[model samples]
Target chain A: MLKNLLMALFVVMQGAAFAEIAVIVHPSQGAAISQDDISRVFMGRSGDIAGETFIPVNLADSHPAKAHFDQAVLGRSSSQIKAYWSRLVFTGKGTPPKEVGSDSEVLTLVAKNPNIIGYVPLSMVDDSVRVVATF
Target chain B: MQCTKFVWVPALFVASTVSAVDFQYGGFLTVGAGTIIDKKESAYDYEGFNCPCFISDFNTAGLYERGDIGWKQDTRLGLQGTVRFQPGLSLTAQGVARGSDSSVNLEWLYLSYDLTNEITLQVGRKRIPLYYYSDFQDVGLAYIWARPTQALYGWEASNYNGASVRYATFSGHWEIQASAFAGNETVRKSGFARIYDEVNQDIRWRNILGADLEVTRDWFTARVVYLQSDNSITDKPDSADFSRPADKQRVFGLALNADFNDWLILSEFNTNTRKSRDEELSIPAPAMSVGVGRRIGAWTPFINYARFWEKSKDADYENERFIDLSATLRYDITSSSAFKFQINRFSDRSEFQFVGATTLLSANYNLVF
Candidate 1:
């Protein structure tokens, strides 16, 4: 029984380590978006992209994809991200992105809003949203 | 002040009943304890407090006395709520319950409107933007130190009734934020005054005008600020030594900070000048703090040095000088909380031994929810 449990844990860790994050936007968003733009938007440094205000959405912190996205795109750990936002939030300087529960919820929200941007595991990408970048 | 405790309750209830309003509430907590581990043989007398004492928090008059472990010096709870009436307009209110005074004080009540995507206008009560961390100093979780170095953060008044305009935008590879503010503040029974005198003293900063600019690129950040105001003091018991007429005061400050993943550096310098109308008394006080830290996984160890010195042209005026050296270790308990332990060595170099010399050991658990 212990061997089986160990095998299952190793498989889960391998899956998490190899998973890729895909940045997504509404299909209606036609303008070219760069990685820098996505980084700025997610960091609350800027909201403008291609002369339009872009709203960034986030997956809940509990989601594995959230950790993957944070490490791959923002180059920050979950603790660092929380600390960064705490400075902005307590000072009333900025607010973090709105959060949704899962990849499906993120896709649904992005599909309904032309300006909303989000991220999910590459395997969860669907026809409702366009994948802008993958890492 | 009894009504202050229930102020947010009504606002929360109103927001809940209004279908169009979006309400969000959060809070921060710090449970801190400290003691004077070592001290000079002679007591340093200053009004109500004496030797073997360390002022852990100068703004709130938080002091750790002789031998007993004190939790009231740094413990506090703060709540903040934002009621968004619309996409561009919102109201924010914050209140803090302090362990030192055992009182709930309303700290911020401001109305903010987005004039443009890059510009914001705010009106009402807000923290005096005197330093980089002044706005969020009460939220201990936001900073790596157990407390801001007292050599610089100690002040007469912390908040003001003010109006300010803030602008934020990206310039090439730099992220820039700038603001200009003007207001006035009056503090009753000022904590800063209590350090020197036993009487209840009132202090006022009138026509307070200030501006600041901050720019960041990658791992580096720089900030500069300038402020000027008319300051005056009045003693409740009519003490001749404490009361001063309106004097012109100006302050200039700068900060340079860098965070390169594993390595971090934080530094700040400030100079303040107060001149009397007759030009007989001119006091210039300069203070600086430098801190460096290295992050290894969830543990970060830091060391810091801070100093405050006052130089007066008049030889008769006694100069006040002090230095603080601290070492701290912080452990991230989770994303929303942290545990920190710090040791401080405070040395009094003043002509009169203003606050005495002592070594302190302190710890805190900080969290935001």
Candidate 2:
């Protein structure tokens, strides 16, 4: 019985370590997006894709999906990204992405606006918004 | 403090009466203290200040004398309000209280219009971007330095009544932003009191026009600017004047920056020339600064070197030169706040030294809300 309990704990740990994140866009967004494209969009470096402007939505600061997305795709820590956006905001150079509280809120908003893009845990992906890439 | 109260009273009154959705507010603060550790007196004493003073600008900010840890030199607070009554149009006003100035000042009050997704126009008072850090100098959380290299970033008049057109665009991996501005400014009480013999002077810049271009690609960025103005100086109590001509002043500046995630590099060079037929008045002033930093987790440590040379063509005028070396450490307390400590060494290289060689120790806590 003890051996069976240890086996269950190892499986849970492995699942947590390898959790998947999905980059989502409006259902009408049909163009392919690479990881670089997603990074640029979230960093305020690019505003358009396929000759149309798009708004990048973000999860709240403490979200687990945000931590995973920032490290795995954006190649930056949360603190570094926050500081980067702070410089731009105070200089009137750019505004940061609008933040929602949870995965479902992001999905709901992206579903309504063709110009909005967002990210969530892969398990939360549904038919309302299209998943462009997954990591 | 009275000035601050006077300005905030009306601002707060307006905010309370207005619809909350139309108005948004933000602010920033920096509390700093510093002291000089020099043992030698200055060779040439400035009007009221004793040496070995840490002269950030000859007479403006960072004026540290011996034996006193003073907070009044760099501490400051700023409040900003934006009113958005319509889409693509907004009005923004910013008020700042400086410890050195001992009064509240209107730093930016402008109406901005978004012509399109990528173009903007602004009119009213705004910061004159003479250096890379000039526009956001008051927002300490935006920069890594405890203070920007003063030798290259100093200016008597930092704002103007102006109109500007800005365009931003991206092509593949390259991003470009360019702007053209025209404006004029008048400073009634000169900030450069030491150079003006302790008398109140009126400095004016007329027919001011300038253009700035910035380009960025990945980790590298570069900026270049040019400005021209008709400069004049007159005594305030009495109308004694300095000789002036149209297009009497011209300035050129360049900056290059690189940020490779963990590594950062910044450099800027500028030259200002007074155009006069008389060789005595046709002097050129040049300044340069270079800095590098490394980020390790939440802390960044940096070093900077800066120099300024005031070379006069006339035989009777003495050239003044100074160099500064600084080491700074910035630790982020949170995403919007930071604590910084810096040590600076200033060396006077001119024959007649106004501020002798000195060392300064300074620290600051900065926050944005």
Candidate 3:
């Protein structure tokens, strides 16, 4: 029984380490997004895409997908991003992206708002939302 | 006096009426103590303080007087509240209390309306964009320095009743922001007494028209600003006192900053002139500062050099000039909190002994909550 429990724990840890994150948008949006575009959107540097208004969504810091997405796509650590936003927030220059708690919640938000772009675990993707990019 | 008591009534009313919207309350605090290590007397005593003293602002005057460690100079608390009525509209109010002022003061009360994704219009009182850090100078957690170099940040009035229109746009790997503002202010008792023989006088800046532009491409940023105003002064117009004739004021400023994740560089230069027929009454002040820092994990160590000079050649005017060399270390206790220790070496180079050479040591714990 103990051996079985150890094997189960190892498998869970391995799965978490190899989890994939996907950047998603509403199905109606068809614009292509590059890594630089993703970075700009998440960093509050971009206000729109092709003259269409859009907003970025973020996962809570405690979520494992958040760390993976920030490192793989945004090219910054969680702390670095926080510090960057601190400068903007205090200066009244910009506000960080709105945050949600779970992948399912992110899927719901993205599916409902064509103007929002978000990230979730690749396994959470469905027909309701379109995958813009994945990492 | 009665008018001052009603300043927050409108804000309170609006906040109360918006029960469904999100209301955010945030604040920042800095408790700092420093001492001037000077042993000799100098002409800085004109402001009733010893040489080597640092003045952060006109009201928060007299810091680190010779041989004294006190928290009354740079310590301050600021509170800000925001009520968002919807996606593109909001009201923000900010108040600050400094150890120097002993009373709470409203620093910002503005309504912001987003006309488009890239344009915003703000109406109400705001900080004058005289320098790069003028907008968030009170938030210590936002910058690495123990304080923005006082030599350059010092000004007679920092706030004005104004309206500003701002435009921001981002291109591939580049971002630009531009602003145009107009405003006026009347300080009943001028807080800047050091330049006027330590006598409190009423001061006014009328028809203030200014523009600021900033551009950033990746790690580098540059800014330029220009402003012009008409100035007037009186000892106390309503109390039967002397008055100084109005004059013309013009200012120009520039700043460049670079951040390479772990390495940082900050620089700014500014020149301002008040012109009048009376040479003694005319003032020309120019200042500059440069800083470099590197981050090692959660710790950042930095050094800065700043200089300010009075360029007016009037024989009747008291000449003032000083240079400051500072070394600072910052430790981030958390994402929103930091501890800083700094040492400053100040030197006087004026024809008149308005300031004397001295050393200062200071420390502060700053946090935003």
Question: Interface RMSDs of all predictions?
Answer: 8.0, 8.7, 10.4
lDDT per residue (tens digit) for residues B146-217 in model 3 = 888877887667788989999999765678999999999877666665444466676778888999999998
lDDT of 3: 0.79
What local lDDT does model 2 show for residue B5?
22
Please list the Cα RMSD from the true structure of every candidate, rounded to 1 decimal place.
4.6, 6.1, 6.4
- With a 3 Å backbone cut-off (N, CA, C), the pairs that clash in candidate 1 are none
Candidate 2 or 1, higher TM-score: 1
For model 2, state the Cα shift of residue A15 in Å: 8.2
Q: What is the lDDT of residue B240 in candidate 1?
A: 34
Give the best candidate by DockQ. 1
Q: What DockQ number belongs to candidate 2? A: 0.27
Q: Which segments of candidate 3 are over 4 A away from where they belong?
A: A1-21, A27-30, A50-52, A61-72, A75-80, A102-104, A120-131, B1-22, B39-44, B194-197, B236-242, B279-282
Cα miss at A48, model 1 (Å)? 2.1
lDDT of 1: 0.85
Task: Give the top-scoring candidate (lDDT).
Answer: 1
Q: Which digits, one per residue and each the tens of the lDDT, describe model 1 over residues B1-369?
A: 011222332332243345455677788899999988774544545665756688877667788877779999899999888887877789999999989866788889999999998899999999988988899898887788999998888888889899999999888999999999999998877777777777767788989999999999999999999999988888567553434568889999999999997899999999989888765699999999999999888899999999999998787788889999999999988877899999999998987657678899999999888
| Candidate 2 global lDDT | 0.79
Residue clash pairs of candidate 3: none
**Candidate 2, residue B60: CA error in Å?**
4.5
